[model samples]
Target: MPGRRARRRPVGDALAGTGRFTCGVPEAVGVKRPSLDAVRGFDRAVYVVAVGQLINVFGSGLVYPFATVHFHLQVGIALAVVGLGLGARSVTTAAGTAVGGYLADSVGRKPVMVSSMALSAVALASFAFVPALAAAVPPGVAAAAGVSRVGVAFVGVCVASGFVAGLYTPASSAMTADLTDAEARDRGYALLKFTNNVGFGAGFVAGGVLYSLASVSVFLLDGATSAVVAVVLLLYVPRSDVGGDEEADADVDSSAESGASLARWWAAATQPRVLALAAINLGIAVMYAQMQTTVPIVAKEGLGLTAAQLGTLYVLNPLTIVLLQIPLVDAVAVWRRTRGLALSAAFWAVSMVVAWAADVGVGPVAVGVALVGGHLVFRTVGEILHSPLASSLMSSLGTDAERGTQLSVLEMAKRVGIGLGSFFGGLFFDYGLSTAWWGVLVVVCLGVAAALLLFERSVTPRENGAFGDATES
Candidate 1:
């Protein structure tokens, strides 16, 4: 035993070492806790990718908040048509995420990321010309184009941009996972989240001002940012960050020998732990989706808040996340990820209950706005706790060979959940069940919290091996 070299623990084993199956304890004496300093020691590529993502998401924020307004009001496209375009984009984006994951594992992360960004730049730039293109067509021809040429062109742009955006997600995530070791991965993701929120919050404020002066210029600016990010990622991020090539290729070859690409995807997708994680994440995603889809509507229509007040509410989420994400990451680092996720769900459940009270008029209009603000703050806590831990957990679930696919599955689940939440949130409002909707989500969040605890109990033994039997030192 004296002469033998010690084997390194697997990522799952390292994760399990915090405690034995139940909620995790703090790290043992002398174990280095995760911190901002640890993040500084991460690979150069991690910072590169984070910078690129910040740039890209800022560009997205410039367009995302205004896309419906531009199309439905300024461009004279029907609201229904604009909604259809967004729905189509969601569908295409989901499909692209699956395709992107496969390509990330197969070709490489860098190529997929760069190409997706380039395509997204082109698609976004093309939005500036849609009004002109629609104008060029005669009235008859526009009618024949289905809800006017603007609708057609807008949908086309949405689909193209959404798919490319989707493609970027898994590739970028996998690249980050490749760059950081398991210990540093959580902070690495938190850093990325911080940058993304800062960029997006800034862009949202800027876009609000610029959209009034020269709306077309906003689209062009967004496109320019995407192009800048594309160039940065291309020139800076090393090709080696593509990652898992030899192992991925061997996996492809093995799958090829046994079955088709679909089969290969199915095999990866069907892993019990991956599915379990995805299912849990779906509930979380649905809870989050309500903020984007339902909260503003309730604040405006139900509580009589002005446009500016609603905007402030919308802004609060990213602001909170940008300020607190890193410190929170350090605070939670010693706990088992599942415990963090469960706490996140509890926070979400409380937020939903608060939201219900606000909708039902807990007091004066001022009180309603205050309640809504509290809702956003609580929801932001859940988001901060969930995002990095979920990403880290998903990353740990797969071997090098199928990590991309594994992350992709998680992305797909989020996409589906968001779509479902938006649909159901709207449906309930339309059916005069707005107050009931919050109650329903409260139950969902609590159920998810309980489920996460159970999931942790079941999976700990398999993940940690002998470590599962031992408490934290």
Candidate 2:
């Protein structure tokens, strides 16, 4: 009996012992059972973080959509000045993300998250007081201040808030990766994005009503929500969920050993695949940036639509995401991620073409509405395909020690792309080339799609479709 290699345990029995799969009588009899944990797509810690993010993003939605309006109308600042302030905020946010990633690796994830949220709350609360404070100053002193006090205060708050956002991004992303294993990470990220859109959509509607009834109240409410999220995270989440160097001697040793942290950071930055993915992400981000900046402007001016009509049409984006994102995740569970990304870009390209048609006035009002609706639906599909896959891919690129830095680098690329997109978008519009802008974006998207295919070939076989059930190895 001993020489018989001991009758091999059934696959179901072995897997059940690992606690990764469910075992039933049928499974014990050699049938395979699906994993319940994989189906749920989250552990307890990740769920807590997702809830906090939902609350935080809801607060952001309550204020961000109205930031430019607040600066231009209530504070009596010029549009150019408001634009400059927003640009500055974007730049600072980019820098903040880079710095935040380094800190997330050196310090712990929880500290960075908690501190960022707390600081963001302070900065947001300060917004409500800026107009009042600016008005309180004497007219002569206000003139002596060069730019208006309101502008200065507003820009300062924007800079501060952007920096805090940068800090939070890498920390939160790395924490999510820490809490989720590779198999479930795709669904985890998709669920997070889903919650974000849900929160933003609900807050957007409520913020509109609140802004009309009492504009100042929106800022206060946003700040209060940030405070609540910070508190919830501090009280509920455990530090051990994301490992940290607890001993003072270990920290000193890490620092004393010829800057080991810096060496690791440099290694992460130089990873060929990481850089390639970041570049692709930058291109995607540029395309996505149009939605927030150029799309609305083009929809209104180029297509001759009213503000209300544009808002109504834009609602389709979030609606599609909420209804279809999870189902799409399940539907595409077997897809190679590279193929999914390429397909996403193709969708964006088509959407851009549709947008171009609407901009050029190629049809009547009813036809134009249909074209724009189709454009939104296609763009939303691209986003659904891209976001979760990109996040999961980046998270897979490095160890826990290096994951924060890698994700940060990816985020920085996105921020830079958004800045470039906004700049180029405005430049094109100003130069009376708005119609051509969509065509250019279409080209960019197609190029990205092609590049991703080449990228897929360049990576190792195991890395090509690691997220799906059919890994080559």
Q: Highest lDDT: give the candidate number.
A: 1
Query: Model 2 reaches what TM-score against the true structure?
Result: 0.82
After superposing candidate 2, which stretches have Cα over 4 Å from the reference?
1-41, 68-84, 126-155, 241-243, 246-258, 299-312, 363-371, 467-471
Query: Where's the lowest-lDDT run of ten residues in candidate 1?
Result: 1-10
lDDT of 1: 0.75
lDDT of each: 0.75, 0.72
Q: Which ten residues in a row have the lowest lDDT in candidate 2?
A: 25-34
Q: Candidate 1, residues 56-132: lDDT per residue as tens digits? A: 87877676556655675578876456656665676677778888888887678888899888888888888898877
Q: On residues 1-473, what C-alpha lDDT tens digit does candidate 2 reach at each position? A: 12211123466654443232344421121212224333363556677888998898777666655654566656687544565566556667778888788878777788888888898888777788877766665667547756677776666676787777788888888877777656556777887887877777666666667766777777888888889889998998766333343532464555565387678778997799999998998888877766755666556555666434555566677778887776675455555578888999999999999888877779887787788888889999999989888887788777878888998888888877776675577567657797888988999999899989988876654455342133355
Local lDDT at 292 for model 1: 57
What lDDT is reached at residue 209 by model 2?
Answer: 70
Give the number of the best model, judged by TM-score. Answer: 2
